[model samples]
Target chain A: MRFDKDSLWYPGIGFAVAGLLLAFGQRALNRYSQGMQRSALWVEHTYDVIRTIESLSSAVSRASANRRAYQITGEPSYILEHRHSAADAHSALAALRDLTRDSAFQQKNVLRLEDLVGARLSVMDDLLKAQARGGLDPRKSASLMARARTLDTRIHGLLTSMTRYEEGVLQLRAEEGQIGYRRTRILQYALTMASGLIILVILLRLSKEIADRQKKELDLRNSTVLMEVVIEGSSDSVFVKDAESRYLMMNTSGAKMIGRPLDGIIGKTDSELFSPETFARLKASDQEIIQSGRPKVYEYSVALPAGTKTFQSSKAPYRDPQGKIVGVIGIARDVTAQKAAEEKLQEAAQIKADFAAMVSHELRTPLTAIKLVIDMIVDRTLGPVNEEQNSALVTAQRSIDRLSRLINETLDFQKLESGKMEFRVSEADVNRLVQEVVISFEPVAKGRSITLLTNVAKDLPKVRCDKDKITQVVTNLLSNALKFTAGPITVSTAMDGSDVRVSVKDSGPGVSPEDQTRLFQSFVQLEGTRSIQGGTGLGLAISKKIIERHDGKIGIQSKVGDGATFFFTLPVDRSA
Target chain B: MSPKRRILIADDDPDILAMLSLRLLKAGYDVVKAAEGSLVLALVRETKPDLVILDYFLPNVKGDEICLQIKADSALRAIPVILLSASTAALPPETVHAIPTDDRLTKPFDISILLEKIRLLLPAESAG
Candidate 1:
């Protein structure tokens, strides 16, 4: 509703300018109209003046003809006619004088014309008196007629001057009317052009303003429709609440969430639509968003017609164009199925850990008895035996030993999976630990005619770790190497940056890259690996877990053709 | 004029008990065996053996309880009692230090090493 200064003021100035131009045009048109009217009146007056002068001239000629008739016939009717013409001539002259009353120059001509007309009348009257007295002598009458003729000629001369003067006045008045007509036409043209220009500018401005307003209104309407569509189309519930905590707007999903129509939901506070407890919780969060101007996220469980469902909702402060926080806007999504799935997975994992612990313990009980009996036989405590018997007993002892190790690995994996693996960290020499594990595997290596090489880096840094776990890791790696390789095996220790790395390399068939990726996962024995090789397939998994618990990295580096090197790196002790 | 050393063995498994006793008897010690947890204490009191070997998962009383019982009795408290278990989980702190038996051993021990440890704990008793 508010317009910027430029947008408001520019059109205002245009209208104001157009208004001024129209006013000026109106005034000029009025002036020209009046001028044309006055010129028309002047032209009429000039024609009236000329017509009166002509009437006066015709009346004087009639008077002179009647006076002469009276002189010759001594007729009273002629005298009367002469008096009537004289009276008409006198009236015409009076009208001419009245019409020229405003012009000093024309008035002078009227006075002279009047004086000649009187002189002609007096001469006619003198002759009439002489004729009435007695028939005068012929010589005396001739002289009298001669005097009248002379006066009459002077009168006609004066009439001609008056007529010519009136003609000149009429001509000049007609030319003035023509000039006024041209002046009025030019004024009208200028007014029309000026008014046209003003109207054009005004119309252009008005149309542009109208079009812009229409465009803005259309854009607003389209966006509103688009927003409504998007909000309704979404599966998540969308809503807006006012500062009073009343529902200002809600999409269909939002209304459906409340189990009400949009009309029923709008303008209602949570107290009206939800339980009192729900209202209080919602109001608190709404206030928090308005006060802090930050979004709030929370989850809640709701029991509906279907089942108990969990939803995570996020609310943010809604602001106006001036950036004043007006209300809260929010969206909520159903997470019931996902939460249920996670709980089920957690329960299954728990059952798995329990089963592993139970089976390991059960297997250990019998294993312990068998191991003890085997120990007794091998110890020669029961009786001395042949070399073959002794060897057979020792083999039984080794198998028991392997069974015990497998049980421990399962238990260890269970502990690791449950995140209950406790490490008793202590400082230990990495090189010496590697040496001990290598020596343990040496007997098996000799039986296979494989050389076991130990390359211990001088001054190899010590690391903090559970000694037994690290020993288990090295032992598994060395065992794995011995089982696979016909060529010499090298166990090496070196300082790798901040970590102390111990690696076992076997010149056996190297693991493929695809298989190496899943090598450490439980139950994922590589194709080249075997059950006859006496692997529980848990050794590498347990080793990876141990190394990770010590915050180290374990991996293999090799290709299909090259021999494989299995390595684990532990962080070097920083205290030194 | 020193008396022959006598060692007592206890386990729920009769086979384990017989095998361990035979090993100890052959190692030149008079071995008394008990297959039940309930008989260990009575036998230990009667025989006054130089050393006692008790399994943790006993039927009547646990090895730690036996250790506690022996420690409670001053006359038998000096007898070295070694508690054996199949698991390596550390004993409860109170049970580890409060009862604080002579020592503890994980089951399925190497016979030679077990003998060495026993000899070390009972230097004078086993020497004869």
Candidate 2:
């Protein structure tokens, strides 16, 4: 019923005009039909008059013929003919008078015809009587026949005129009837076409509406299928709960998280899946989020059957269409590995601290002996001293110095592990550093009657490294060799792959395979090391760390009962 | 000058034994030496030095054992015994006195500190 007025055609106006035109046309047709009724009656009366006149003419003509024949033949049959003709003429005259009663023009014609028929009948009777008299009167009979013929002709003319008038009236009525039929048929056809058009329009609108509805329904179905796929196919656990806080849905991961069979968590509370203490905490957190209508995220640590583990959890309030908080949702991730690394770091820190304390305690005893003797000598407390005593004092001082060196090395190793060792790098002569170390061990080699030898590659490059630390490395190796061997200790240097290599060799019982593996470990002693010579067992370990810090390497080569050679490499004129 | 009071000392360090004996003798006390803790009790009985200085952690007998043995003997118990150890901090007061050592001297002590400690252990007249 609502229309857009900007349209070109006003269909409502067109329909109203067509309806008015049809009403006017129908009224005109009804009025014309009323007039036609009167016309029909006139035509019917005219037709009746015409039929009467024709019958009267035929009767007169027959009477005239019989009269003539009877006269000529001198027979009595003529008399019968005259009688029949008179009766027929009289009845036809009555009928014609009745038909023309309502039509004055037609009535005049009918009365004239009736008069003619009567005169004719009288003439015929006269003629017949004369014939019966049997007097030879041929002329009289013929004259009478002529009179009859004239009367017949006059009647025929009147009848023919009446028929012509009635036919004209009937032709006018038929033309009006044709016009009415055409108008009625056209109206019927127009009504049928309009109704069909309306029906077609209705069907088209309904089909379009159905198509739109089907499209919307199909979209809704597709989205519903997509949502189902997302929920079912996700790797993370997904779940939902009703307003009453009962488990309404759960995905596979959610089921595993609760440590239950798939779909077993339905209708179960958090309390059923967790320990009582954990359940209480979870419920409290859930309530907090639900009440605040905001998401709350946190992490929790739990002791499972496997081990203690940490879980990062996030929770948010589930809401209804009206935005009323219904329940809560959460996702959790295990963080056990991250927590284990933190614990390991703490344990390492504690070990370093304990090592520092042990080293301090172990070093005090040796320092005490050295200081007591030195104090006595400095104080000149000894009344007299022989050359041998003085020499012994120097030896005691040297032993104490060795003890201090061991303590310093232990401290240095501890510092390296704690990432506190500081390296001061400078350009230094690698050859000279190695030579000085060998000279310092010369006395020890002499005491054991071992030859101390060196091999320096010609034009050896200067190394960019900590000179003092490298010298300490060479000295430590030489000292170990001199302490254990009776034959010879050799120092050698070479250049290989952008680095200078320093090696110290000894003729002594070499390290066992078992001891070699632990040779560079702090506090580790080889098979013969502890019994043959006293060592803190940290020299090789410390030297290895220093070389590695210089971006080089240290290694050992030895066989049981054969001599051992220890070597280290330093970068030459290059820093790494 | 009066003769030095003879002091018998037992220590593993030859430097300490020679040094302390010389110093004590120069201080006007006769000094005797026993280089081993095992010899301290023997020196106390035989040499009968006026005082004994015992070093802890010797090769044979510990200094405290010698101290206890010397104090337990009725004849030698009268001689003052001074104990020297690197771990003087570890010794409990009761354990220190459980031995007959009159005083304790931790190692690396200055010559003056050792002298003061020795003087405290000895009788005033003999220390002078």
Candidate 3:
């Protein structure tokens, strides 16, 4: 096992603990082995001492048997056997003395056994000496035999006690070795299990750390890849600068904008990429965005090989993870073509207005001449006219009036389009004004066989309007109503909240749903049930412009086959 | 009839100038005409017309300028001047209030309206 940092000291401590456990296990096993060795030596020593004692006792008995046989038959070979057995007993006694040197009780027992064996041997020696003299000493032999027998009995008792003590020492040594063996086994198992658990905990912690680190790194890498794709995919030039005003990142378009490679652009300041003048301006704006933590947008033009190009740049503060403003991120879009198109459109509109004014002026003078000539004929100023000639002159005059109206309306619409319409605002007696206008239109309505009805609300609130402009608006609406209508046409006015609502109801073929949508737009003629009594189609458009200038609302309401009511609301004079 | 009270009319258009002169003449007023802005003041001085009709735009001087000059002069100041223009560009309120004229009309105006405006500006005896 190795060390781990995330867990600080866990793995280090774990390994150390495991090492200690291993050392302890080794020590315990070694101690157990040594203890078993010592216990086995003790058992062997005890067995050796017991066997020595037993041999000494058995030699004494063998010597006794040989001495009795020699005494009974006086055989020389039996005498030699007795002498050899006496020697074996002395050596076995000496070995027992050495084996029991550490035990005082075993030493005392050995000494006692040795003395008794010596006395028995001496008694047999005296009898053999007497027999060796060739004299028949039965009584002396019998006496010696009796003394040996007594010594043999005491020696046998001492030998028996020493053997018993030696056998008990061997049994105790074996029991001690068995207990050491069992204790070593228990220690070994405890240490091995603890070390294994420690190692497993260390291993598990190490793998988990690795996996977590790998996953975090993987997420960061994936996000970087995704951001790169988005930045590169966009057509706008995306750029990022660090707090030090050095380029930190530039997308493909951003690099292309400067005609530089990515390597050349990154880490470079704006001064290195842009001209000195442009760089200063760009840096100032960047500083403002970064310091104020606000976004900046501006349109700029650059002279290129393909003439001048315009760009709209948007820059915002770039914040770090903690939301602290660190730099600025800029996105610039090329608007060269769009700006050019807008300029051309404005130029074309100006040209059209100039042409319309010229044409209107040119046409009005001639029309004035024609109308004057007709007026002379109608007035019978030059000469009296026949009824047929007068009637024909009236028809031409009517057509000329229509033509003049179209020219005036077209020019008015142009002036309105160019934001040049002048309005004179004042408080007016709207009710009287409407009455006077209706009275003027009565002759035309009667000649057209259309009844012109009026319903002027009494106590109608005065309104703030351009008197002439409003008059023109109402007159246009009324004329439109008269043109499409022959049935009873109603002109009404009422106080509508803060406004004066004026309406002209015409029993004409109602406008279709689709035509009503663009009814107020220029050049829209509602081809309804009424025959197309020709108009410039600019009348409604001009009227709408006038009403809007007065801060009023204009609209129409009608259904299929139902009469139409064109209404407008002029803001009342509430200042009073 | 007090020698049919005199009037002067100025217009750049030859036809409008002629027609206006004819109308005033038919109304039994001594009519004088000038097709130029400079001629109208001279005609007013020469004929001592009771009224002057000046087109807003003329050859050299503008109708409003001529009206201002006439109103400024002690001699022709009392002679009422009616200004007219062909192009429909109405003067702004500030400019319109700045200029001095008895009446203003757009061209191709009803001849009867002009007659009524003239009759209203003249003395009762001269108008009848």
Q: Write the per-residue lDDT of candidate 2 for residues A119-203, one digit (tens) a residue.
A: 8777866866665665637787678768877877787787778777767767877787678667766775675566556556555
lDDT for B37 in candidate 2 is 69
Q: For model 1, state the Cα shift of residue B74 in Å.
A: 10
Kindly report which residue pairs in candidate 3 clash with one another: none
TM-score of each predicted structure versus truth: 0.74, 0.37, 0.68
**Pairs that collide, model 2:** A381-B23, A383-B22, B4-B30, B5-B29, B5-B30, B6-B30
In model 2 chain A, the worst 10-residue window by lDDT is A1-10
Writing each residue's lDDT as its tens digit, candidate 1 over B7-125 gives: 88888877678777877888888998887777888898999999998887788887778878888898998888887777543333344445566877766666777788788888463
Model 3 lDDT per residue over A1-576, tens place: 333565667778888999899789889999998887888788778878878877887888888789878978989999999989999999998998888899999888878877888888888777777767875477877777778777877887777777777777777777877887898989988898888888888889878977887887788899989989999999889999988779998899877766678999899998887777777877888888988899989787765444567889999999999999999899999888899999999888878777887788778777888888898889898899999999999989988888888888888888888887777678898898888789989998988888998999999877777888888988999989988877989999998888899999999888777878889998878774235468888889999988887778999998867988999988875442
Interface root-mean-square deviation, candidate 2: 6.8
Judging by TM-score against the true structure, name the best candidate: 1
Q: Which candidate is the best by DockQ?
A: 3
Error of 3 at A283 (Å): 4.9
State each candidate's chain A TM-score.
0.74, 0.41, 0.66
List model 2 lDDT by residue over B1-128, tens digit each.
Answer: 54556778787867667666766767777777888767777777888887787787677898888887878899987888777764433344456556756877655455577677777766656333
lDDT of all the models against the reference?
0.80, 0.73, 0.83
1 versus 2: better lDDT goes to = 1
